[model samples]
Target: WLKPFWLKGTSSSQRPGNLYSRPLPPAAMKTLHQEESIKVPKGIKVTIKAKHVEVTGKHGTLKRDFRHLPIELYLANSGHEVRAKMYFAKSKQLSMLRSVCS
Candidate 1:
């Protein structure tokens, strides 16, 4: 008669050999910390202060506070563009901020 495998106190899900016993390459690790930027509209005026960002346009003015998350807002391109930069952190949150700004 044939014997069952479960009676041996081992299962098929167990790995017999090393699965992840090596370190990633330098190039691969560098990609983990990436930088991203967002541009401001041409007509709109974006002012980044210590705590929040004030956007003014032909329609009206809007203010957005950023005291909750660990993000930095600043201007680039010789005061022609506003960029939101991120470094070595959660990328998912950055995408959410980008989508909302756009």
Candidate 2:
């Protein structure tokens, strides 16, 4: 019987391990922190508590719930700015943070 070329001298690592049928690479990954902020105008009130943000201004009060997201939201610069932050962020998380911040 004849044998295929790839089957003759291949190791386990050379074999494809996913649905795409492509070999997986052995590499290291890093995690870091991500932060984004926006300034709050003088007349607007910004509050952060219990994974929620409440903004009060001439247009009335608006509140948003962020409990579902993995990032942290806080007030900084003496309540002059609002920031969204995430620690030990992976690539997937970084992308999400960027979208949310921008």
Candidate 3:
């Protein structure tokens, strides 16, 4: 009798996976903290107080409250720039952090 095509191998250990597979090194851990800074234009005024921000320009003014946001917002670089920062973020929260920073 003729053996099947797959059965032509020497044994289970002779399979391609067994011959090529290897234990890879552990992956590096993801960062938990992220920070992004944005510059403010000379003609525009940005005000940051706690989690609240107000942006004023020649056209109009905008106010926002970020107390419910997962990330933290602040003014930096001598109040000439704004920063978005997040701390202790995991996989799920990483998306949120990136979305806000973007």
Q: Highest lDDT among the candidates is held by which one?
A: 2
For each candidate, the alpha-carbon lDDT, in order, equals 0.64, 0.80, 0.78
RMSD of each: 6.9, 4.7, 6.5
Per-residue C-alpha lDDT of model 3 across residues 12-56, encoded as one tens digit per residue: 656556854556687757667888778888898988887888999
Q: Give the per-residue lDDT digits (tens) of candidate 2, residues 11-48.
A: 55555563446745865464667788889999999898
Better of 1 and 3 by lDDT: 3
Candidate 2 vs. true structure, TM-score: 0.68
Q: Which stretches of candidate 2 lie over 4 Å from their true place?
A: 1-22, 26-30
Worst 10 residues of 3 by lDDT: 13-22
lDDT of 2 at 2: 58
Q: Which parts of model 1 have CA positions greater than 4 angstroms off?
A: 1-32
lDDT of 1 by residue, 1-102 (tens): 444664466544442443444554654222234444667667888888875888899999999887675556677886577666556555566675565446
Which window of 10 residues has the lowest lDDT sum in candidate 1? 27-36
What shift in Å separates residue 27 of candidate 3 from its native position after superposition?
Answer: 12
Query: Could you tell me how far off, in angstroms, the CA of residue 86 lies in candidate 1 after the best superposition?
Result: 1.7
